[model samples]
Target chain A: MTTTPTPSRPPVPGPPQDTSPTFVGMPTFHRAARAALDDTQQRRNLHHATRTIRDKRSRAVAELPHWEELRRAGAAAKDEALDHLADYLIRLEERLTAGGATVHWARDAAEANRIVLDIVRAKEAEEVVKVKSMVTQEIELNEALEAAGVNAWETDLAELIVQLGHDRPSHILVPAIHRNRREIRDIFQREMAAVGRPAPKDLTDEPSRLAEAARLHLREKFLRARVGVSGANFAIADTGSLVVVESEGNGRMCLTLPETLISVVGIEKVLPSWDDLGALLQLLPRSSTGERMNPYTTIWSGVHEGDGPQEVHVVLLDNGRTHVLGDRLGRQALRCIRCSACLNVCPVYERTGGHAYGSVYPGPIGAVLNPQLRGTESDIDRSLPWASSLCGACYDACPVGIDIPELLVELRSRVAGDRGRTAESVAMAATTWLFSDPRRLTAAQRATGVAGRLVGDRTIRSVPGLGAWTNARDLPNPPPESFRTWWARERGGGTREGSGR
Target chain B: MLEPRDDVVPSEPRTSGQRVALFATCFNDTLWPETPKATVHLLERLGVSVDFPADQTCCGQMLTNSGYGSSALPLVRRFVDVFGGYDAVVAPSGSCVGSVRVQHRRIAEESDDDSLADRVAELGPRVYELSEFLVDVLGVEDVGASFPHRVTYHPTCHSLRMLRVDDRPLRLLRAVRGIDLVELPEAQECCGFGGTFALKNADISISMGSDKARHVVGTGAEVLVAGDNSCLAHIGGILGRWRTGIRPMHLAEILAATEGTPA
Candidate 1:
């Protein structure tokens, strides 16, 4: 017998809105993840790469006996900075000005972008070389600069690969992490020429070769660019110094060589004291790239009169951070040090790749961070919270004690309860009502157990309504008798053993 | 760097005035009765009394994790009402206990129910997942069971990370006589049986689950065991669909098996 077909999805609670520019008009996470899951090469690349990195991180972290103390200190430093964020910001600005640096405050992405664009326009530079920055990507500074006829060149190797390939970053640290070496070779061969210097004609998939090709291609842009833009990993409030950490020396080049330099920093990157930096330094490199220390750590307070960039500008960006700070449950996300350890460890991030998150920040941290940074009004932001299995692997890997699973669940509550009742929420409400009382649960179980008995012992290969589950996996037929029923009949339910076997 | 808290793990069963209750959990009650039954047998063998509170339905995990935090408040209250008197609450699930400990508190505080929040705090540590109950609280690594077969244990994500019951199940399995326990490759990775995640992100979940299945198959173990039946059901479904000829047994099921009793 045939039955009526029901629509697979109930109505979405809110209108679908994609807030991030790089992935504008992107679908919800599951839809995008479904597509990413189909890409066999990407899956293999992510699986191998993440496993290698995860193993390396474990070894690196094992070396530090006092790693927990440093981690706690780092988290405490961030919390302390965030607690008195206003005071720190004022002190930071004061120190920066005293050290002969200019500073700008941006309340939002538009303001941040505007501030950067105005700086580039003032310098009259056609192109500005950039240190790899999640904040810059968050504000879509390249797009903003490009729109105003100013080119923003990503100087970091991974960011450069993403820029040259015209692909959105998939991971926070390794932006083109979804692309294997072969794909990177292809990207360099095909896309690098149009941007700057052409890739070598005899380019292979060798790592060293790819580095050489990128270095050679960016050589001209580095020399030609007069202005540099960057984002700091840590902005020390005490000395007003901005620190940029990198494996490659490209961040250093962007920090010093340009005649005019500007740094776009998140207000949350503040470290309360110089003493706090070493503890965080120990945690970050070990957690981030599994290195004892990053190859290059650039700390510049201000202009040093012919030593570095003649002029320096620091833009302190809010950009919805205050909104996140207001949320007691979610404020811990601000403690993130931009370490991709969570991304590397996440199984969901491993399977789906970063594009599935549809934002600059992806992985477990992104799942919690994106919603708070960009409100849950958008479909992608709303769906981000559900992107995980609530696996605490991210939290386990987090060096800064950002309880990512807790944050994800908290954000999920905001997504569910803060909105108008959807079909899913109504269904959850029904289950909640049934489970609130044991009798209701027992009565329902009894009815289901009776139905299950009638269905017999056959495994359920497929269910018409739940094709998502049954299409791939087979569920066991429910046992004929519920545990409660079995206990009541044979073991005398509710009879206490009371210290007697 | 959460410090290794393995010291908190008890190595033998406690024999005293402590009262124990089994939270069969909604899923195990209706679908997998054998697991809870095996749990009872295993506990009885250790001279520990186990009580099943008839009023215990669920720990409100499904509702809370599904984003219905407020809706979970009633069920949270229901949980306290039922299990509040027991000295220790045990379940055959790590995820459920993680919820009762983690999400229940989040729900109470998020909804601003001060009394419920305090009750959840008091109740959190008393709740133990199976492996934790057996190795950490009961403090017994061996439950006097003999399973003569090749077995591989998949440490459920919640058990491995959330509950941090590292090596407890393995220690229990290691103590079992006539058992060849091979290490599962990439065992720390999730099996991808994330409730609605299996439904919503079906493709990714399948990808992750199938990979886990591949690792489990590579072990050449006759039985794939874990603490949570929910994860087993998902992994076992893939194993079943693929006709891998492997059985998915709960940890308690294998531990409860004695001479001439093959689980």
Candidate 2:
């Protein structure tokens, strides 16, 4: 097994300490989103990449005559599986145990992290190689592993890019979508010594060259790592098994070569049975990568004679999932197959990109899920619900029929009602008082009309509460006459239908 | 203005229940009270009892949408009190009806008033927008209304997707003897009124509004009708600025119009 040399460099500062302040220190979804908006290069990369995937997905989806049926069945299966989750978990646990797979239940992120750490320690492994896993990212697993005195190497190419660049993932599939090949080449030049093989002496900014650079770096980890960690796309309860679907074979190598395999999977990842897995296997790849089938779909049940990892541990994580499940309206979020069709189709997500969401999950699903998982108390999560245009594109694109726009609106209301803590409450109260009475409403409109006249062409340009709005747009001027005046004039004169217009 | 026409003066086919209360929304009450007046005149013509609830007010949707839920709770409770047990509580706006039905329960629960929450939930499903109540609940699509004009329907977001009252308004329009109900292309997308959303994200809002206006003009309908005037007003404002051949009118005003009646 080739051993990648650890690059020596000044250590980067740790994760930001302020978790309680919500959006206090974080930039708004708008500003954060704006960073990538004007980068024509990044926009070209994203637009080209996303459109290709979208076209491919449409073709793949159209090939299946039962695609819609499969989607419905997938949704129904998820619903039924969630309905009987406790029973399914027990069944899953028993079968897995009988098959020589140990199952650990984690209530939240911390517990799951500790469990994975313990497994790595017990295996006496100094380093663990990882396949691409969002759950691991969500738990900040690499940071935990590093803190516990171990190196967690990312094997997936995109994951490698993010890890090597010391950056947060901006897009779910691409992770480093914000970076072009040249920037990637720069990162490789700087960080490649971390792996034993340095970047090619004359590496070009070509895609193949960058990919080869990463492959050369990761090939060593795939062969040498004693422990491997992964996140499952689906865990089948009927037969004790875990499945990782991916475009690249890196996931396969990570799953099979390691002595001890540890998987940190969200509890919501479980499917009811094998037939359910069959349907999902068909849906996931097409919706996710727009491929007819994922190139590498590695499914492992338990210990086998002379093949695969002998020591298998599955860590089932709750991590605010039960609370999400408890909500009748919100629980449907758990049904996500993570196809990311919604994200690809979302106009807001398209323009703003993913980092603005300030969570592992982004796009319409992120807007609803993040707030629900963390609760709306934080300003970041609160602002997420308002991120969408309520355009319903996400809903249209969703395979499982998660009503993202409705959920966003629901979350927005919850945020607004945060015990009346915001300035909007005061404004609403005052406005309501003026509006409930007819006479007051007319007076206020006339008053606004007059005030609108003063701001007429100069565009007021700066207002405190509304500056967030006018920053990019203009406020319309109220007409000289309210509709009431128009009506009154039409009535006073001869009542011709053509008289008003 | 026509001598303050206080006396009924025998309008055609007037209904006789004076107890019906008007829940004129902030949009209608402030921006366009003519909608409420049209509602009252229309309901009065159908011989239905109509009363302008002196305490009737905003459904608190604006505050609730803005993420200020606690302040909006009182408005929910008060609206319930003012209009709850009446024969029916009708708002000219689908968004307001949606708030009363959809959001009030949420607000009531937040306030820890289970009973009030339960009541709001119970009364909420019954609260209907004017066209919905008239057609779906009241079973009266043809209000003896006659407006000889080409009209297209704009389905508000809350009304179309939220309430899922798809064909009731169109069915009513179809039944209207003289009104032409032209099909609107992409009728389900929001007009971007979104309560405070129009002012909050005016750029995207205007973009969405322009899209909607383009659709409205595409139909070549002389008039655009919608259940919620807030959406109509936003689209109307755009149409007014662009001087499109189309004018906006509420469904209630169209249903209320009789022969020779100015719509």
Candidate 3:
């Protein structure tokens, strides 16, 4: 079995795609997801990668008997923090400021970008090395930084592939899960510098060689960078500390090696205290990387004394998170620990892959979280809630117990409430009208049975208001006799003993 | 309206007096008629006198899940009217039962029927899935039912996730007489027959169903039992296609098992 080295994956050559970050006016999920789904290579790459992660996660999770309890605590803690978020933010700001770290609050993506760009410019740094940050990906921060004339180099291996390849992250943990070894080999051969070593002179798809190539390429940038930017795994409000957990130690280098450290974090990533932080630390690594402990767990509190970074700045980003928190049923989505367990176990995510989600977050959690955070007005966002088969695997896999399927249905209802012409809602209303009274249901069944014979083949090739439904499957033409009709016929077509209620 | 203290059973058990109405779901009323009978049998065996209100019809779960709150209102009203007086209402099908217990209030509140909403909220917790009633209300894990089949249980999504009745079915299954319950891998995952979702998105639905089918086959059991027939039908169809040795049955069918009778 080809255990393709994770970091050795070839770099995607171009800069990131120029499509705007907002999923506004994009095609429906059926269209967008299908476009991605049609690519057999992407599907295979995703299937193999997700399956590997899921297997490792199950084993890692199984090792802890109290995983469920730990998850519950983590979820509860996050919920509590969200409920009193303003207070925690005040506390965190006070603590961080006291510790000599300047905290900036950004209400949305534009503000956050402005803050980071201003900080990088003020530092007068020509370039900055970044640890892979999903929030930055969410806001398209690298592009923003580049547009502002500051070059940001991605330090995470998978992130480096995505940035260099000019591709969107396909999976949360392994952003480059959509590209295989041979594809990586091709990309590196095409993209890497010919003046310096020229990609190992026909580099085979061997994992080690690829990893060595990435290590060599990234090592130069890491040592040369004067400023570093990153996203935090968690922020402890009580200690005014930030944590970054990763399988690779590269994040540690980005956090500590640079003279100035700038971390962009979502406001919802806060925990009230260290005990709360401890609960999540146990829950996150196992659920995310399927590891007992992440290879590197870095925690930095403000400006350390002659250690790590002398100048530290933490930008707490809101960006619709406050709005998400205001929704009672929808608010639970903020509790996500970014374990990607939900994505790994999700069948829809398994098939369509993460890029189709049109956001940094994907899978069941993304289906609910993205639409709420971004507002479900756009076609892609509206289509997301319907992306799932409502299988609830993500809920099962979620260490925080997000109840994702319920939220998906809830969001779908909100979307339908917006459109006001879903046909599903109409059919359901008609069915309910019939079911409320048995007489009507039976009459309707008989009427449909008559219609069923008129169709003859008992298969409808087409129907109005439901084009997608007929794409691959057919309705059973109301079944020759309804179960009610069969019951009556079996009882000699006579009014059975309790037939007329 | 009524005395709040008199309506709900307190945390402490009051075994001397309790009442319940059996809203035999449409599927259980006609297609799987024995499910209601089994539910009644199990409840009576546990010293609870259950009333099968013949006027009860479908709970409009099909309508509500399909997003028809307006049409489902009358069904909710009828349900609240028919089974209103009983201390508790129980049903064999989790999805149907879950609809009544969970969605009924949502539908009523959306329709602006405040009184109906109040009634639904009161009746909600009282409406339990059969295993939930057996375990929580009747306070007995062992219902004294005998099923000798080598069976594996598929915990339907509505029953497990929506209702949060995780251990009820498993607890009862473990206590059954002469039953060998093989643990199903990924038992919490959905079987993919999400009401009309199976018909609407059959390709993706079948993909999910097939995955569930494979997991069922992996259990090496002779039978698969679940609370919802909608899910069972989907899994059964896939099993039929594969010509797998296992068949899908309902928990009620398993619990209704008699001596020397094959389940």
Residue B14 shift from truth in candidate 2, angstroms: 17
Q: What's model 3's lDDT at A455?
A: 79
RMSD of 1: 7.9
Q: Report the candidate with higher lDDT, 1 versus 3.
A: 1
Give all candidates' CA lDDT scores: 0.85, 0.74, 0.75
* Model 2 ranges with Cα > 4 A deviation: A1-25, A28-31, A34-87, A107-111, A121-126, A147-149, A180-217, A291-293, A322-332, A375-379, A401-422, A431-501, B1-24, B32-57, B68-160, B163-263
* TM-score for chain B of each model, two decimals: 0.93, 0.89, 0.90
Runs of candidate 1 exceeding 4 Å displacement:
A1-18, A493-501, B1-13, B111-113
lDDT of 2 by residue, A1-501 (tens): 122223233222222222322234666565566565656686677666666777788788889998878878778878777766777778888988989999999877777889999999888899999989988888788988998999999888888888888887867777877677888899999998966678998999999988888788889888999999999988889899999999879999999999899999888888879888777888788888888888998999988978999999999987777778767678789888777887776655655667788887888898888878777656567678877766566776677778887688778767666656446666767866764554565566678678756666553444687664445333444545454444445443312222122
Stretches off by above 4 angstroms in model 3 are: A1-19, A22-24, A194-198, A202-206, A448-501, B1-21, B26-52, B66-74, B105-122, B130-153, B163-188, B199-202, B213-225, B237-263
Which window of 10 residues has the lowest lDDT sum in candidate 1 chain A? A9-18
Question: lDDT ranking from best to worst?
Answer: 1, 3, 2
Give residue A25's error in model 2 in angstroms.
4.4
The model with the greater lDDT, 2 or 3, is 3
Q: Is candidate 1 or candidate 2 better by DockQ?
A: 1
Choose 1 or 3, whichever is better by TM-score: 1
